[model samples]
Target chain A: MSLDQSFVGRTYPPTAPYQVGREKIREFASAIGATDPAHHDPEAARALGHPDVVAPPTFPVVLTMAASRQLIEDPALGIDYSRVVHGDQRFAYTRPVVAGDELICVNTVEDITSRGGHEFLTTRTDVTTTAGEPVVAVWSKLVVRGEA
Target chain B: MELPTQTFQVTRADLVRYAGASGDFNPIHYSDRFATKVGLPGVIAHGMFTMALVGRAVTTWAGAPDAVVDYGVRFTRPVVVPDDDTGTEIVVSAVVREVTETGLTRLDITATCQGDKVLSQARATVRTAG
Candidate 1:
């Protein structure tokens, strides 16, 4: 099944808040082998002007990826999860995510196209605090391979 | 200007750790049987995991952990990981493509796994430390 082009430009409701935890950030950093003290130590992050341990730039994926489930699971979208492959990803940050921030994601379909027996869907997710402070904008492109 | 290259080791353990951390439990990144059933050679590394490593390279070059203002990448090839302890290696390198007057540095990044390009059009805009 192909992605619905009509869904392009449609913005979904904001997701439930996700609390950014210091231990989660530290675990993510450790998984990536990032040894930056600010990612692990609240003191180091505070020294760098952050209120608590700061997350790596890619940490937002943990939120946006899950948030995109809203779109991927939409019956109108008709996405075949088994055939979907991640094509591209991007993140633009106003500031690094610090521990304790309650973040929400609003996903919007940016584009949908078909080519070479594949359907491509691009979604942009705006991440913000519950107080409406924008934290980051994330874009992800998923390619659904046509049935063989 | 060319930035110093950074290489990251991607082991099966690392992928498992990343999968748990990122909440992406895709079997293609862990179970060889599932991956092969789905037409992959074997268990593969998560594309986001590779991007995370590249992000590490970018922030390290900028000399600040939180310097990246923007980052993006297109996955070109999967980094296939064997079941061995030494899964694979991704080498990340970048060149300063441009510098803005407002202290932003645009970088063109390249990430390779076993001499094959895994990511294309990888780039980052960073706020350089003044």
Candidate 2:
């Protein structure tokens, strides 16, 4: 199904708060093979001026990607999950995500276009703390391949 | 200025770990049968996993753990990982495109697997250590 251009600029409600945990950060760091001391030891992170273990730069995807499901599953959007492929991703951080922070996401449909028998949809997710502090902005583009 | 190149080994074990960590359990990244049925060469690495590795290169270059201010990439190609102990490798290299007086360093990044570019139009802006 073709994406409806009218959905561009549509914004979804803020997602439920996700509490960042030290073990989660450690697991993610380990998965990516990031050996930074700050990602594992709280003492090491505190020495580096962080209150707790610091998450790797790309760790926000754990939150944003799930939050984006609201948009992709929107009946009006009519996104066919089977035909979708990740096209691009971007992250702009105001500060590194730290363990013990509660983060929320607001998803917005930034743009939509069709090309070469495919439809491309870009969504921007603004991540912030529950207290209204901006943390990171994430953008993701999905390409839906047309059926032959 | 050109930064030193960094290489990362991506094994199937790594994919399993990343899938658990990132909550992306797409069978194409693990099940060869599913990947083949879906028209992929084989089990492929997650695009975000590659980007995370590249982020490591950026932060390592900045000499700080949390120095990245902005980063982006387009998935131009996939990094296919054959099921094996040795797995595959991704080489990440970057050149300083510009350094602003305000302490921002802009870099043009390239990430390749088997000498073919996997990420295109990749770039990062990082805050240099004082």
TM match of model 1 to true structure: 0.99
Real contacts recovered, all predictions: 0.87, 0.88
Model 1 chain A: weakest 10-residue lDDT segment is A1-10
Q: For candidate 2, list the clashing residue pairs, or say none.
A: none
Tens digits of lDDT, candidate 2, A24-138: 9999999998898999999999988889999999999999989988987897998998888899999999899999999999999999999999999999999999999999999
- Which candidate leads the pack in DockQ? 1
The TM-score values for the models, in the order shown, are 0.99, 0.98
Residue lDDT tens for model 1, A9-125? 999999999999999999999999899999999999999999999999999999998999998789998999999999999999999999999999999999999999999999999
Tens digit per residue, CA lDDT, model 1, B1-130? 9999899988999999999999999999989999999999999999999999999999999999999999999999999988898889999999999999999999999999999999999999999898
Show where candidate 1 strays beyond 4 Å: none
B1-130, model 2: which lDDT tens digit per residue? 9999999999999999999999999999999999889888999999999999999999999998888999999999989998888999999999999999999999999999999999999999999899
When only the first chain is scored, the TM-scores of the models are: 0.98, 0.98
Candidate 2 segments exceeding 4 Å error: none
